[model samples]
Target: MANTTDDTTLALDAVKGEHPTDIFSLDGEGDWSPHITESNLPTKIIWSPTMGFSTVDKDVLAICEEAISELEKAGVEVVVNDSIWEVNPVESWMVFWACARARAQQHLIGTEEYESIDPLLRLFIEMGVTMDGASYASAIDACHHYNYQLEEAFQESPLIITPATCGQPPKLEGDGFVNGEETASWVDFTMGINMTRNPAGVIPVGNLDNNLPVAIQIIGQQRADLDVLKAMKAFEEVINFRERAEDF
Candidate 1:
């Protein structure tokens, strides 16, 4: 939501508030300081090569590796751990996401409002409404299991790194290219984290051959937003990517 760690904190503080109807909002108060000073940099972090995917584009993988090398040169230990999640949580996450969307928009089904919705979103709503409650419960169970796996990973290393996206930015009106294939599912890297509600940050690591920027995802243990920001700031300093697109 912001260009820098300081800006992120400022934006969050401005909008963070309690609402009687918003049950999901955090209930208690705690320190929000980013603690991004040089002395507070993470000593060790985990890097998942494929980010729980079957394969990632070779160029994107190389960019992540180069970022890891830079962090190592800055005295941070980068541990290679490909098997972050034993059971891939993408399917379960999709089921849960679809069901949530259905719950919110199901009332409009068969109405003119429904016809006005985008076709892809209408498909999602249809998928959600047809899903059985037992399946939804199963998805919830699977998500809990995945959350436990992430908690274990956090115990070993407070932070985990992965490619922010599977490949370069997609065209404005077309699917993304990954591993030489055009696909719409190029964003699976962040699904598990979203399903588990972990705190994640992204920083521009480098630009692709086409001049589009590529970034790495730094995910922290649930509720460890400050630590994630600290790592992002530390790594941001190491990479020092300050170039702006000339057209912008």
Candidate 2:
């Protein structure tokens, strides 16, 4: 389910237990790859930066290869390449800022809204979530690009299978979450899907030794939410995925 072009696929390497599974690569299938690398990153990430993280984790790549071997045995076509897919994290940040602004404004003007909202609004204000006009325009362009590309891609391929996260879910350090690369790393796979406004859902595949579960994310095109859910059901049946987290 991982793209050879994306290093996040290496996250699968961290899985514990048996790694038996089918793997296959498709031909000319950058069909699922959405390019989002540091080089082409936005000049200003109103939320945070996407740097300092290694592009390719060798250990993770090795683990991904093993899983692919099993998938190939299952008659899946795995595409092998080193190209990057296009994605802009800023688009989602724009959406986040819009929501934050709406919530903050509601709290300021209305009564009996969510309690302690001022503190949350203050945090976002400090983070530059009230982006500039230029930034908002750029984000709008990015969203259009995403919708166009994703819609076109769906015409060729109805569904895309990918790792749900870069690796095992991390337990929070304390009461709050980390705000930089650490947080970005976890959503590396799902973020692009969010930007594209595609419907994506994850189905459990297996569990790590720490008892954290791993999943395979299934994504469908815009306005195809039902199709995506239907595909998830079919895939779960095909994999015989269970509610319980089983050994890898």
Candidate 3:
């Protein structure tokens, strides 16, 4: 967890001039405190333990830390706690299977034409081909679980910031696909939003030492899509992110 320190540090340094657009304390709301704003940056960040993985590369953590720190120092409120609920493993698979099934149905009905598709995608279609009643029940359960968690988190804070990806962009292979494990890592920071059906967006903030882009994700409650976009637009004005990129 501490491994993200360096990358996050550099990332903050990269976007030195940005400032907060609005500052408000969540003190009276729930179990969270407004004073977390005064603590060291990471201590103020809230991540879900249910989203655990085997290993997070040092650089991945670094970028994450940097983004959080910069946002905090600029006067945005941050919360360090388990603020969201967890979904069952079966529920997670059911969502994926449902999406795959739709894709397979599209292909079967000849909606579009392509010379070929990725082998993994083909496998996904096959997996979804047999979706049953149990699958539908699991999907509904997952929807409710995610909506509840999102509602709980939003009750504490209006905005949630997270790493856009687990780490830097992957080096695409000749087959145009990374291994299953690596691809999974890339989506670590994102798939939860998909499953939860929340509105989220990615804003490019800085670059890694190797010139790879680093982005921070902004997420909000369901049906608050416009509010989420407005927040990002305000952030864009404060960070003036494109000007920073031009400097690079």
Q: Judged by lDDT, which candidate is best?
A: 1
For each candidate in the order shown, give its overall lDDT on alpha carbons.
0.80, 0.47, 0.54
In candidate 3, where is summed lDDT lowest over 10 consecutive residues? 25-34
Q: Model 3: residues >4 Å from true position, as ranges?
A: 1-56, 82-115, 174-181, 238-240, 243-248
Task: Name the lDDT of candidate 3.
Answer: 0.54
Residue-by-residue lDDT tens digits, candidate 2, 147-243 = 6765554444566555555544556541211222344455565556666667776666555544555566666666554455554444454454355
Q: Which ranking of candidates, highest lDDT first?
A: 1, 3, 2
Instruction: Please write out the lDDT profile of model 1 over residues 1-248, one tens digit for every residue.
Output: 76776677667666665668888887545445545564567899998877554467778879878989999998888888888776657788879878888999999999999999988888888899999989988987887787888788777789989888886678887777787787766676777888778889898888888888888999988888878888888788888888776664
**lDDT value for model 1:** 0.80
Q: In model 1, which runs have C-alpha deviations exceeding 4 angstroms?
A: 17-19, 28-34, 111-113, 246-248
Q: Highest TM-score: which candidate?
A: 1
How far does residue 83 in candidate 3 sit from its true spot (Å)? 5.7
lDDT of 3 at 159: 66
1 against 2, candidate with superior TM-score: 1
Q: Is candidate 1 or candidate 3 better by TM-score?
A: 1
lDDT, residue 54, model 3: 22
